[model samples]
Target: MADDTGHTTPTRRELTGRIGVGLVMGLCGVLFVSTARISGGESIRDESGSVAEVLRERGRTISDLTDAAASKRTRIEELTQGTSSSEDRSQLVADAVGLSAVSGPGVRITLSDAPTSALGSIPGVTPDDLVVHQQDMEAFINALWAGGAEAMMLQDQRVINGSAFRCAGNTLLLEGRVYSPPFVITAIGDPDAMIASLDSAPSVKVYREWVEYVGLGERSEPLDEVTLPAFEGSLTVDVARTG
Candidate 1:
């Protein structure tokens, strides 16, 4: 179609089709970007949620172990009171040990700072080095169990299954309080066997070196009877389901 200037203009149908195509392309681009952003955000949220879940599970496991230990102790006490026969007593004792091995006839280990000469010979004993660390305490407790401990305790705090032995800046954290030297860890087990096992353990022997050189702590007072406290903690396990 020629206009007055002999130039042709676009037909109405062609202009409408061009406009519709442009609108469709713009909509598709917006949708693509929005989908990408949403997918990335969901990925980050999923990762964070997974990490939180793992930590929760770990906490629950620790709690359950503590509760189980406590329950076992209570059951043993009941059994001991209900029967007087030698067989019954023996069975009760066995049950108690099974719940959480208690040590008997064990030795008490007291930790403190060493003499000036001893401290000077090695790395200067700091507050951190003076007291027992959680790992050391755990090693000692584990060794006692291996050596047939009937029960164990650190001072008045019972070393239960849930018992946490942590050292922060020379301060001992047990159950829920800060303890200072001389930090005493008592175990009830065969005195000879416990002592031998402790003396032979690499961890104990290492600590013993600290004792000889830095006087980290000393072990003594082998008693015929030393009772350990029962476990105290929660018992619920929170599990995740996969489908």
Candidate 2:
């Protein structure tokens, strides 16, 4: 080593001593850094914990968290499936019970009372024979149902499982509402099938006979699309029998 002014130089022993001190200081620094890194919290070990013990604790915590996350994910999936299934079932039930509107290819039937002028046109004919009756509507309803009708409507209301038709004079009484002829019955299904059922039903045949004999007004037409409203009346069916 030379002095700052280049006027003095270090002896060989002095140079050797300086080199040893530098080596010792470098070793000490290296040792200090290594010890601090081994005990650092981010390196999986603190001052009080060994390397193996720290690694084991961290592995267990990671496994537990992973298991907990997997369990919650499974429960969430189950809940999602259950909710969708319930909604699908509810929709099916509503459609089956006529509590939901339906639209599709169908048939429409109109039944009206005969004109007053036709009252005496047929022999042995009475006033009842000139007008549509509850039985007439019931027969048609039954025929439509037998024809695989998905939904049916009478007048402006939907026909459900417990639909009851009653007549007052020449007007139709249904579900606490009054309707005058011509009464309309609409069914949503295969038009060809429903028409076949209407043609084969005995009761419908009887009504057709009346149509031919007394001019009782009856007309059937196929519709490209027919819509039926949901039933909005009471769902009760009161029955009485002999005790």
Candidate 3:
């Protein structure tokens, strides 16, 4: 408020008014940001719709796809029966079936959300902190894959190249089926390496922190012999792309 000639500054009242305006503006900015963040979070929470109906439709589609894949495989086998490539055909069948069920020494992982009573007693802990999430499962699965697992099963369903797992609220959606905790994962591979990978995974590390502090579920064990069943669901394979 000083002039070029270094005259006296504005009165105290004027400076106080300016400071008040700045504080108000700052508060408004903070409120805007907070409101936006809350709205964005609410949108994500509200967007998922009618889970039961969606799962039912998905199950129907998978059943149809399974039937079609079986028919296609049978026709292919008949056509290639006496061909020189019969061995290749047999190999294809073996790989497909192996993806469905593999019996060998491997590792087993079991994870579940903390009990409701434990969650309630923890200060500063939200409900989200007490539940198993999709990311947690993905991180564990990816770690096993990196450890060179030959095959994997989530619950009783085999994991395929096209397999995708998702969660709505706390329920897991896998291969058109819904599952609740405790979630079990079986992977056929070098148990030592798979366990090591789980120990080193970054997401698993974060999950373990929660496990320690907030009581989320976590357990891994090696199995002498385990067999996973074939994936009974159908997959829609798209081969063509359009621009």
Best-fitting candidate, scored by lDDT: 3
lDDT values for all models: 0.66, 0.82, 0.84
Estimate TM-scores for all models.
0.50, 0.61, 0.67
After superposition on all CA atoms, how large is the RMSD of candidate 2? 30.7
| TM-score, cand. 2 vs. native | 0.61
lDDT of 1 by residue, 89-175 (tens): 776755553334454566787766544454456665654565557677767777777777767777666665545566664556564
Candidate with top TM-score is 3
CA lDDT of 69 in candidate 2? Answer: 58
lDDT of 3: 0.84
Total clashes in model 2, counting residue pairs 3 or more apart in sequence or in different chains: 0
Q: For residues 121-174, could you state the per-residue lDDT of candidate 2 as single tens digits?
A: 657778877999999999999999999898999998788887877777777666
Per-residue C-alpha lDDT of model 3 across residues 1-243, encoded as one tens digit per residue:
778899978899999999999999999999888977878846644656686767867778876877787788778768777666776776677676553356899999999998778756888888877899999999999999998898999987888887888988788898767778889999998999999999899999999998988788888999999988766665556576879
Higher-TM-score candidate of 2 and 3: 3
**Candidate 1 regions with alpha-carbon error over 4 angstroms:** 1-104, 115-127, 229-243
| Candidate 2 wrongly placed segments (more than 4 Å) | 1-84, 236-243
Stretch of 10 with least lDDT, candidate 2: 39-48
Better candidate number, 2 or 3, judged by lDDT? 3
TM-score of model number 3: 0.67
